[model samples]
Target chain A: MSIEHRDDTGDRFGMWLFLYTEVILFSGLFILYAMALAKFPQQYAEASHKLNIYFGSINTIVLLTSSLTIALAVSAIQMGRVKHCLNLCWVTVALAILFLVNKYFEWSAEISHGIYPGSEQLAEMGEGVTSFFNLYYFTAGLHGLHVLIGASLIGVVAVLTAKGKVTSDRYTLLENSALYWHLVDLVWIFLFPLYYLIL
Target chain B: MTEHKHEPVPYRTFIQIWLALLVLTGVTIAVSRVNLGALNVWVALAVASVKSSLVIFYFMHLRQESRLFKICLLVMLVILAIFIGMTFIDVLYR
Candidate 1:
């Protein structure tokens, strides 16, 4: 039945290996998060409770919808619907902007309250609270970096679509980029709960 | 490319997943209100794990991929689970 091509297999394997590196990168931050949560459970719980759940929930929905659009974009490309694919990609990008905007307000509110890493609010809360915010900023800063990068990739995907570089038969780059975007969204899906929701 | 009639994307599937995610989010929020103490954390994590798996399987199309890819991913997952389990045990228990 199925014939295997070494070239295709090799490319896929390489892509997965690269994903492994990404996993390792995020795992480092996760380790720090776990340690901090364990060391300062009360402070961490309090800090988490202060997170704006309305924004957090809305951001999750936005990211989830973006994931769906990107998946549809990939599906369109596979089906040779070039125009549809491009439109869906743009939709995904717009949704990402919505996410970033929500993140902006969320962070701005927290920062205004002086809850940033090593700020006055943290100082008043004492050592554990300070460390909790430290971990909060550190872990979330890295995840924010990832979101920024994913947005850039979204731009690139749009540019490629406009230039007619991505086609049904040659959409590996688009597919892989979309995969990375989904992973970014997936990470946030967990981080929202870990950092904001649970006590 | 294979010759075939074009079909509409699974709009229903997408909507179903959206509803499922919304329901899960509500469930998580409700659970947070109940405060099962330390057990609440585990409950939240369990719910998140389920949500993430649904995303990976349906949203990411992992279930439709080739068997080889699936096997490789499974192996990786098992290893990651072991690694996380060991660390959590060390941190929480020891």
Candidate 2:
């Protein structure tokens, strides 16, 4: 049996195709969010105002910085700087964890205030506010899940990178991981303003 | 088969783009604080679009990717736009 060789360009093309599907999936949710906003403009504004802009902005910066670190990790490996690449990957993972930590705190603060979905406080609120929190939880929760998956993916790549399996000559895995990390950051870019800023 | 060789993007470029993204995030927050009425949403979204574009173009190296990838992205975005537009038609009128 002949072993099929890897094709870097083809691999990247496939990754991009998968990414397109992800975009569409998230777009569906964004559509729901937009429709809800349109339906309850006043409520959305009021609900959005309840979000802490400082926390949101800090998380945005964290994700953006992580994106940069991951990008640099790819470049580092491309240049055969394995140690630098590993360091950058670890930094990216750390930043992702930090983002989640901040999110946990933010959500806990809201939940303690009974602003979470299905809470009595949210139940007392009108349908618009209910819709706002629902969309907020769904969108941000999905994004957080992606972050976890992406970080773990990068973590595996980092291990492979340390084992010399993902070398400069064969860094497609690292490159693809960076792409996924960037997509996570890209989603947050839209989520940040929609949920935190657009009051 | 000859291995494809990619030009390593400079570290400085990534830093610069990161700085730009942070600045844009700050700008969006500041802009949102103002009472722009209906245009507020538009402005926030526009700023987000710019930030995402920068991430895609530089951080994701979409600019350096093949034309096919770019076309795929454009098409996906067009489809998303159509979906949103049609949904808005229903949402706004009904």
Candidate 3:
């Protein structure tokens, strides 16, 4: 019975431990961002102004909405509304897709203008500007990867919920997935300002 | 199913937090519009901190977690702060 006994709290704590390490991983990039900013403060300001604030702000709202839906999905399952929970989870996933699509268009625009890393255009712009674009692409690319992973995790949770493996009384998986989704949003909350807002 | 009994947050609360987050999103963009000189970066970071706190506590359910979880989070944050401070200090002295 001990082997079969489930400890939901322990499972959650395990998830939190994983989350802590994920935060640490991103902090490493943030440290690099600060170093690069210090090295090329002028290029940082100029490069930021060229970024499309419309895309960044719109994506921020989209991710925030997804966070709300995922949280509500957890609450829905806890209340035994399994269908509602599944629908909310799908809604959250849809928003994640929307966010990624927007990112695609944004990156395409930058690339079309010959703004990508290693391009002759960027090389002509000097080392400071080149470094700024490099950091922007690397940092935002990593964060976008997280959004993709988080969305896939939620999709798995949704499938489990539909099969009744995740339920009102036993929802550690759903909670863990929601926690990961919220963390994705949390990272973007900082990235928005750092990349687009503060010059 | 080990004695699972706890009050789940109401749907309204999540909605309210979502609204607040959207408003903060607007505020951050609006504030960034103004030229705050050297204070712009600090202001942006401060607002971002507040927004993340709301998500961490309410959305992530950190408020309902045990003391150990809270301690772990605090410790992680402290380490992050130390890392950030050391990086800036290194830049300043170099």
CAPRI docking class of candidate 2? high
- Residue-level lDDT of model 3, residues B13-89, one tens digit each, is 99999999999888889989998876888888899999999999999998888789899999999999998998799
lDDT of 2 by residue, A114-193 (tens): 99888888978889999999989999999999999999999999999999999988899999989999999989999999
lDDT of 1 by residue, A1-199 (tens): 9984435344555666676677667766777677777787887888778788899889888888888888888778877888888898888888888888888888899899998976876799877778766766776677777777877887897788778887776676777777788778777777877777756
CAPRI grade, predicted model 1: acceptable
lDDT of 3: 0.91
Across residues B1-94, which tens digit of lDDT does each residue of candidate 1 receive? Answer: 3322223347567668768977897788788778777788787788888887777777666666567767877777787777777888888887
Instruction: Answer with 1 or 3, whichever has the higher TM-score.
Output: 3
- Candidate 3 has an fnat equal to 0.82
Candidate 1 ranges beyond 4 A from true positions: A1-9, B1-9, B92-94
Output the lDDT of residue A170, model 3. Answer: 89
lDDT digits (tens) for residues B7-77 of candidate 2: 99999999999999989988998998899898998998899899989999999888888799899999999
Give me the displacement of residue A111 in model 1, in angstroms: 1.3
TM-score of each: 0.87, 0.97, 0.96
Please give the DockQ score of every candidate, comma-separated: 0.43, 0.84, 0.81
Model 3: per-residue Cα lDDT over A115-158, one tens digit each: 99889999888888788788889889999999999999999999
Runs in model 3 lying further than 4 Å from the true structure: A1-3, B1-4
